[model samples]
Target: MNPTIKDVAKLANTSKSTVSRYLNGSPVKKETEEALKKAIKELNYHRNENARRLVRSKTQTIGIVVDSITNIFYPSIFRGIEEVAKEKGFNCVFYSMTSNKYKESYFQNLFFEGHVDGIIMISFSKRDKQELVEIAEAGFPAVVFGDSAGIPNIISVDVDNYYGIAELVRYLHRIGHEKIAYISGPEDAAATKCRLAGYLETIGQLGLKVNPSWIVTTDWSNEGGYHAMNQLLADGDFTAVVASNDETAIGALRAFQERGYHVPTNFSITGFDDITLASWVYPSLTTVKQPFMQMGMKAATELFRRMEHGEEYPSERHLLKPELIIRDSCRKISEPIATLK
Candidate 1:
C-alpha cells in the first residue's frame, strides 16, 4: 500500500488535522509548510484519487461564474469569495460570461459535469436564471448573487436594487429635475427590470412625466452608455440623467462634454454602482454603492455551510442595502431656475 496522509503527517511531526487542512488549501505556517512538503517528498506520499472519491464526498474546490471583468462590481465580489474559500481550504475556479448565451451553457457544463463541488453565479441575466433553478431542484447546491428564481436548493443574495434606484430618482426629483433621461442596461437583465421598475414607479409616485424618447437601453458597458447618451440627446430634452451604472455614467459624462453640456451645471447626472472610476472623473460621480465584495463573501459562506450539511444547510436569501455617495456630478437646482444660464 502507498503511504497515506498519516505517514506524511507523522514524518512531518504534525497533527493529522493540520496536514488535512494544508491539503485542503488552508493556510499553514511557513515552517509547517516546508516540513510537510519535505515529508511528502521523502515518503513519496500522494493522494489516492480513487480512495478520495470513495470515502470523501468532496473536490474541495468551488466554481464561481462571474460577469465580465469590465464590470467594476465583479472584482470586488470575487475577492470576498476567494477569501472565504481559502479559509475553508477550498480553491476557487472562476468563469466569466457577459452575454445571455455565454452564461447559461458555460455554467451548466461546469456544474453538472462534476468539475466543482459547488457553484456560485453572480450578476446573471434573468431569462438564463431558470437553468439555475433546475440545477438546484435536482438537489445540487447553487447560489446566485444578483437575481435568482428562488428555488429551495439555491441561495440567493440580492442587493436592495428597487429601493436604491427609487431613492436616487426621488433625490433627482427633490433637486428640481423633472425631465430626466434614463440610460438602461439590456432589457433581458434582471437588474434592468428592477432598476426600470424603480424609475417608472417612482416617477409616477412623484407625479412627474417621462418622455418615451428619453429612455434608451443598451449593453451595460462604457461604450453602450456613450451610444445611449447620444441617442438620448438626439431626441431628448432633459436637465438630468440617471445612468444604469458607473461605466455608463462615465461614458455619458464624456458625451455631455462632446456636446458642450457641462455636467451638474447644465445637466445633473447620477449613476449606480459607485465604482473606482466614479471618483476619478473630472467631476466626481454621485451614485449608489452596492456591497459587491460583502455579497460575494456571504455567498461563499452559504456554499460552505451547504457543502458540509447538505439537506441540513438552511437555504437563506440575503438582500444587501445600497449606500448613496454624494459627489460633485449631481447638483441642486432651484425649482424656478431649473435650466442652467
Candidate 2:
C-alpha cells in the first residue's frame, strides 16, 4: 500500500489542514514547505490524483514549466505547444521557475491544486525529475522534455544528446582539428553531461590525447561562456572548443575576437542547438540543430491524447536526432594527423 496524506502529516508534525493547504496550491510557510518535502522524500510519498480530483477540478489549462523563458531555444518550442493546445481548445499557462527550493511545492499547487489538468516540464532538474516521476507514477498526467528525464517507466520527449555532440566532434575530426577543448553548459543539466561524454568518448576513439584542464563547466549563459573561453585562452592552447549550446558558442567567439584570435584561424569552435543567432553570427556557427518545435508539438499532442484516451497510457519516449550544419567556423589543417599529435 502507498503512503497517505496522514503519513505526510504525521511525519511532518504538521496538521492535515497544513498539508492540504500546501498540496492544494495555497501558499504556506517556508518551514512547513521544507518539513513536508523532507517527509515526502523520506517516505517516498506520492499524492493520489484520484483523491485530488474527487474534491477539486481541472481548469481546462495545460501548465508549462521552463527554466528560463528568455532562453532562445524555447520560443519555437513554446509556439509548437501553444499551437497544438489552441487546436485542441485548451489554454496554456507558462510557469517560469523562480526559486529552486520551492519548486516542488509550487508544482504540487499547480498540479494537485487543479489549476491545470496536466503539466509539461521542460528542462527538469534532478530533484524536479524525481518529483515529476513520482507525480506521474501516482496517476497525475505529465510529459518531460528538453533534457534527460531518465524515467524510462514514464512519458518523456528529448533529443539524443550523445549522438548530437558525437556528430559535432566527428565533423571537427573530419576537418582535421586534433586539439579541442569542451565548454559545458550548466553543470546540473543532463545535456551537459551527455555532450561532455560525447566529446571525451569520440576523442578517445580517435586516439586524441585528453587534456584534463581543457574542460570547463559553466551556466548556460552567454557571459558564462565568454568568461570560460577567456580563462581557457589565458591558460591552455587548443585548436578548437566544442560549446554545449549556441549561446555559449556566440560568447566564445566574442572572447576569441577580444584576444585578437580570429575564428577558424587561431581557434575553431562548434555548438549545439541551432538558434536564430547561430546563422547571424560572423562565420556562422557550425552547430547541431535540435528539433525543438517538433519536439514541443509531439509532447503537447501526446499529452492531449493521454488526457482524452486515458492516463494509464504506456510511457512514450521520443529521442529525436540532431542534424549537423557545416559552415565556415572550422578549417582543414594541412599537417598530417601524426604531425599534429
Candidate 3:
C-alpha cells in the first residue's frame, strides 16, 4: 500500500494539512518540516503524480493592489504589510492600478496563474465589486481595505467613514457652526458615499439647512479640492466647510488663504485622514484619523488566514475606529455668519 499524507502526518504528530503545507513549500514550523521530512523518509513515501497534481506549490508571495503609490496614505499600509509578510517569510509585490478596473482585473488574474499565494486590495473601484465577489466565491484568497458592503463571504478591513464624518459634523455644530458645506470625493468611492451620507444625515438631524450649492464633488486630490472650493465660494455662503480628507482640506485652506480669508477666524474647515501634512501645515488641521497601518496589517492577516484555511476560513469584516483630532482649523462661533466674503 502507498504511504499517504495521512500516514506522514500520523508519524510526524501533526495535522495532515500541516504535512501538506510542508510538502507544498508553504510556511510551516521548522520543527514540523523536519518531522515531516523524517516521516516521509521513514515511510519511503514517494508522492505520486496525482498527489503532485492535486497539491500545487505556493509562491510564498502576496500581491498588494493600490490606487496610487504617490498617495500619502498608502506607505503606512505598505509598511504594515511588509512587517507581517517578513515574519511569515513571504515576499510582497505591489501593483498600482491608478483606480482602473481593467488594471485591477489584470493583476487579479496573476494570482490565478500562481504568481502569488494571496492578494490584498485597497480602495478598489465599485464596478469591480462583482468581480471581487466572484473571486471570493471561487475560493480565492483575497482581502480588501474598503467598503465590504456587508458581503459575508468577502474579508475586509475598513474604518467607519460614516461615524467619523458624523462625529466631525457634530463637533463643528457644537462649536456653533450651523451652515456647513461639504466637499466630497469621487461619487463611486465607498468612503465618499459613507462620508457624504453622514454629512447629509447629521445636517438634517441637527435641523441645519442642506443647501444644494454647498455640496460639491471632487476627486481625491488637492487640485480637485482647490477647484471645488473655488466653485463653492462662487455658489453660496456657508460658515464652515467639511472636506473629505486631509489633502482636500489642505487645498481648501490654500484657497481660503489665497482669498485673504483666515481659517477658523473667517471660516471654519475640517478634514479627514489626519495625514502627516495635516499637522505640519501652518495653523494645523482638525480632522479624523483613520488607522491606515492597522488596516493594512489586519487585511494582510486576514488574507493569510484565508490562504491557510482555504474555503474553511470564516468570512470577517474588521471595522476600525476613527479618532477625531481637534486642531487649529476650526473655531467656536457665536452664531452662523451670513457669508465668508
TM-score of each: 0.73, 0.75, 0.77
lDDT of 3 by residue, 227-270 (tens): 88999999988989999988988888888889888888888999
Q: lDDT of each model, Cα atoms only?
A: 0.79, 0.79, 0.82
Across residues 1-341, which tens digit of lDDT does each residue of candidate 1 receive? 88987888889997664576566544455777899999999998887776355332467889888776666567788899999999999899987776657844456555444578788877755645567655554345567787776555567887877777887899998888899878888876788888988888888899999799988998878899889999998998899889888889999988989998888778888899888889999789999999888888989988877666553466777888889888988777773434656
| Alpha-carbon runs more than 4 Å astray in model 2 | 1-59, 100-102, 105-114, 335-341
- Alpha-carbon deviation at 291 in model 2, angstroms: 1.9
Best by lDDT: 3
* Candidate 2's TM-score: 0.75
Q: In candidate 2, which residue pairs clash? A: none
Question: What's the candidate order when arranged by decreasing lDDT?
Answer: 3, 2, 1
Quickly count the clashes in candidate 3. 0
Give the CA lDDT, 0 to 100, for residue 3 in model 3: 90
Of models 2 and 3, which has the larger lDDT? Answer: 3
Candidate 2, after superposition: displacement of residue 118 in Å?
2.0
